[model samples]
Target: MLSQKAKYALQALLALAELDEGDSLMIGDIAEKQRLPKRFLEQILLDLKHQGVVQSWRGKNGGYALLKSADKITFGEIVRIIDGPLAPLPCLSRMAYRKCDDCVDEERCAVRRVFASVHDATTEILDSMTLTRALNGGEVRELLRGTG
Candidate 1:
């Protein structure tokens, strides 16, 4: 399951992708528009800024904006940043690997193989999707639910 932080991060990014021309947005504005809490939004944006996914501006007209093109940022990247890994289990994870302790036959684990396929499919979907694509794909509600 995607954490709230991950979902909020994506929502905020999609909101910015609507105007991905390197313009800043007040954190409060993104919160209200995306139906997220102000302080929480601020924290997520801060973390994203730290990751260099988004940049911040300071002053009367300051807030947040994508550091890179919205089309260049992948959902998988952000999800990895926020949720840690895309795989269902640590042993199945390619990016963040950790062998399971109790597994007797990791070499022939059918469940691990199944999860690997699922992870691969998920990776394919998210890697191909960018914030701009999600925003331009359809209405915000549909995009959030990932179906229209």
Candidate 2:
């Protein structure tokens, strides 16, 4: 499940992505436009800025904006930043993998095998999806329908 914080972060980023290049949006404006909590959005933006996903300006005309192009920012990156590893279990995690104490043979563990497949598929999809694709609602739907 995606955390509310991560979901909000993506929403905020998408909104910023819609703006012209080099344009910044104030937190109040973002919260009002996206129907998000202003205080919560401030924190999310701070975290994003710290991670280099966004850059902040501190002045009268300052706000938040993407540090990179929309296509360069993957959903996987945002999710991992806000929600930690995407793996269902620590044993299946690539970034934070830990062997189960009770599992003697990871190679033959049926649970691990099943979840590993699921994790691989999920990771591939999320990593491949960028904010640009997400913003293109019509094109994305058409592409998905065609793929299906």
Candidate 3:
């Protein structure tokens, strides 16, 4: 599952995508359209601005818009920004790897091997899917690992 942060980010991005040229959405507007709370949407948009996924203009018409075209930005990248890591195990993670304590051998663990493949496959699909594609209701499956 996407974290609350990631879900909100996706929602906000979709809302921004709905705007016309040079048109920006206010926090309240995005929250209302996305059914998110204003305070939470504000923080999420701020973080997205920091990440350069979106930008904000400071004024009455100010809110946020994509720094780049939506199609150029992949879902995997956005998820990494908000969710930290997509991999189920830290050891299998590319961006956020940390050693697992219970594994007797990092190089030879069957559990790690299976999940590592899953992570790679998931990333492959997500890396190809863009924010616009998702906003358009693209048919990407949620590649959530574990926690059945």
Candidate 4:
């Protein structure tokens, strides 16, 4: 399941993608438009900025904007940034793998195998998806079809 913070981050990015390039969106405007809390968004945006995913400006027109084009950012990347690894189990995580404490033999672990499959498929879908495609109403099936 996606965390509330990750969902809010995606919403904020998608909202920013809707605007023209070089346009900055105020945190308050994003909160009202995306129906997220102002304080919460401030923290999320700060984290994103720290990750270099978004840039911030100060003053009357100051707010936040994507550091680059939407197509350059993947849902998987942001999800991992906000929610950590996408693997269902630690053993299945490519970036943060750890053997199951109770497992006798990872090679014979059926549970790991099943979860590995799930992790692979999930990663494939999420990694391939960009905010650009999503903002244009592209669906996962459509992205899989290479139409978006």
Candidate 5:
């Protein structure tokens, strides 16, 4: 399930993605435009900045912008930044893998096998869905339909 924070972060990024080259939006403006809580957005943007997804400037005309192109930023990367691993089980996580305490044989575990396929499919789609693809109405619909 997508966390509220991750949802808001994606909303905010989509807003940023709409900006013209070299332009930026203030945090309050982003929150207002996206209908997000200003305080929560501030924290989310800060985390994204630290993760190098965004860059900020401080001045009368300063604001925030994507550090890279929209097509270069994938949904999987953003979700991982905001929500951590996409795996259903700790053992299935690539970045944060851990052995399940009760597991007797990981390779033979039916639950693990099923969820590993789930994780792989999920990550495959997500990693391929970039912000540019998301911003396109047709692409978004196709992706949701599992036909992209």
Candidate 6:
């Protein structure tokens, strides 16, 4: 499940994605435009900025903007940034892998095997679904078809 913070972050990013090149939007404007809480958005933007996903400008016209092209940013990247690993189990996480306490043999664990497939499929679609593809409709469906 997507956390509220992650959802808001994506919404804010999408709002920024709509801007013309070299243009930026203030935090308040982004929050208002996306109907997000201003205070929470402030922190979210800061986190994103730290992750190099966005850059902040200072001054009268200063705001936030994507550090790279939208097509270079994937949902999986942003989600992992804001929400950590997407794996259903710690053992399945590549970045934060840990042995499950109850597991006797991971290779033979039925639950792990089933969820590994789920994790693989989920990550495949997410890693492929870039912000540009998301903004352009039908790309997700096409990605889904390709994955299957």
Model 3: residue 38 alpha-carbon error in angstroms:
0.5
Let me know the TM-score candidate 3 reaches against the reference structure. 0.87
Model 4 TM-score is 0.95
Report, for every candidate in turn, its global Cα lDDT versus the true structure. Answer: 0.85, 0.89, 0.81, 0.91, 0.92, 0.92
Q: Which ten residues in a row have the lowest lDDT in candidate 2?
A: 139-148
> lDDT value for candidate 3?
0.81
Candidate 6 Cα errors over 4 Å, as ranges: none
* Model 6 per-residue lDDT at 6: 94
Prediction-by-prediction clash tally: 0, 0, 0, 0, 0, 0
Q: Write the per-residue lDDT of candidate 6 for residues 30-115, one digit (tens) a residue.
A: 98899999999999999999999999999999999999999889899999999999999999999999999999999999999999
Clashing pairs in 3: none
RMSD to the hidden true structure, all candidates: 4.1, 2.4, 4.7, 1.2, 2.0, 1.5
> Model 6 Cα RMSD, Å?
1.5
Residues 93-136 of candidate 4: C-alpha lDDT, one tens digit per residue: 87899988899999999998988888887898899888998887
My TM-score estimates for the predictions, one after another, are 0.89, 0.91, 0.87, 0.95, 0.92, 0.95
Those runs of model 2 whose alpha carbons end farther than 4 Å from true positions after fitting are 138-148
> How do the residues 1-148 of candidate 2 rate in per-residue lDDT, one tens digit apiece?
9999999999999999999998999999999999999999999999999999999898998999999999899899999999999999789988899999899899999999999998987787778778988887534344444451
Better of 1 and 6 by lDDT: 6
Worst 10 residues of 5 by lDDT: 137-146
Q: Which digits, one per residue and each the tens of the lDDT, describe model 1 over residues 1-148?
A: 9999999999999888877475788988999898999888888998999999998889997878889998899898999999898989899877778899888888799999998888877887787788777766734454446573
Q: Which segments of model 4 are wrong by more than 4 Å? A: 145-148
Q: Cα lDDT of model 6 overall?
A: 0.92
